[model samples]
Target: MGLRKKVIWITGASSGIGEALAYEFNKKGAHLILSARRTGELERVKENCSNHEESVKILPLDLAEADQMEAKAVEALAMYGHVDMLINNGGVSQRSYAVDTEMSTVRKVMEVNFFGTVGLTKALLPEMIKQKSGHIVVISSVMGKFGTKFRSTYAASKHALHGYFDSLRQELYEHNVNVSLVCPGYVKTDVTINALTGSGEKFNKMGKGQKNAMPPEEFAKKLIPKLAAGKDEIYLGGAELMGVYLKRFVPGLFSKLLKRVRVT
Candidate 1:
């Protein structure tokens, strides 16, 4: 569908893929609701948009606070009277082994990555169904398709999104609502630097894969058309995307390869 004048609400708009998407969508003449925990960073992103004064609205949100999602959804619907699309892009990453990770840390990751996303979607779903039109886009990861070292909870959270949204897609299909699950391989973003450790502290270091991953802007540029095409499942990245296939068709070989790959 054409994006001109479409009201798109995107979480995690302060940085990374979400930020790039805001700018790209703005370029397509789409109205934007930018959200994240950092109000200042949200404002920075808004100001950087093409028509920030008229087309962009800042809505500071913290996904970890899932309880507030309904209220936030009401506030968002009030902004444009209706939302054409909701991008579930706000999430935290884990950089800890499952055995080393504390239960609290696991809960924190699951809360932010899975529960929070689902809560927000559930809040807005009624409105979309009422309108009989909407697009739900999720920015999942390659880890969603397969597990690796140091990302047990992170991978689980992503896997949960696939299950939840895949089912949601079937239910929403007859209602004219579209659901897109976007599985991104490594992208050059601060996700790694801000990833949670076993103790819940920030990883604070960019991994080799992350440093050399696709640029967020480039990734966004390639993603917009696929989104417009209403693709049910979208995958973007480098060779890492191949793992999704390997795990699907040749689990034995994929499992052997996983042991040797440096996942961080």
Candidate 2:
């Protein structure tokens, strides 16, 4: 029942939380399939794992390519004959106002963050159902629970994830497949640097909150235990975590306070 020898596929494994998870899981003797659009970086991450030669493999993938995910899912399953868990961590972030954001940028974000994730999950869902055992972990954001400035579209995609996965949890209950939604507040990752602006250009700068965010390694360490405990949904991060509660308990007060938050 522990992570030992469990085959876990982690997308966005080239860096940030995914990379950190790879290392942590590797130490626990889990077999890993690391994935991302950056094959070279994935290889580097593989090399750093505990038993790189036999315990880890890399699969290059672009979550934006929703059309190809079903095929990729087949390929992923073939890597180890079965996958005990799939971590849907590949996604893009946003850094622009709704009015200034172009339709194309909005669509691109949704495509990669929402549709792409769903496509890949659907591709793997049948197998999980057939086996009657599997775990689906989604790396959503605090924005999923509440709206914030400069993250309208990004928030929308994450919100969509919650709705889709919450329903999925109920549907898969009888089948024994588990869905865990991880809502991260702020982590010190390159997400901000690569966030898309209204013009569809990279933001290229880290925000104050991001710079002061939790380290991915620490975040991963704290997360795995909760995940292993079979939590359905978990909120992880720093001071920003209060937003999740305030949004639920004090909707009006939270809305007024959200307006003053400097999300960038």
Per-residue CA lDDT of model 2 for 19-118, tens digit only, reads: 9999999999999999899989999999898878889988898998999998898888898899999999999999999999999999999999999999
For candidate 1, the clash count comes to: 0
Q: Write the per-residue lDDT of candidate 1 for residues 162-212, one digit (tens) a residue.
A: 999999999999999999999999899999999999999999999888888
Name the top lDDT candidate.
1
Candidate 1 stretches greater than 4 Å from native: none
Alpha-carbon RMSD to native, per candidate: 0.7, 0.8
lDDT of 1: 0.95
TM-score of each: 0.99, 0.98
Residue-pair clash count for candidate 2: 0
Error of 2 at 203 (Å): 0.3
Point out the worst 10-residue segment of candidate 1 by lDDT. Answer: 255-264
Error of 2 at 234 (Å): 0.5
How accurate locally is residue 133 in candidate 2, as Cα lDDT from 0 to 100?
A: 97
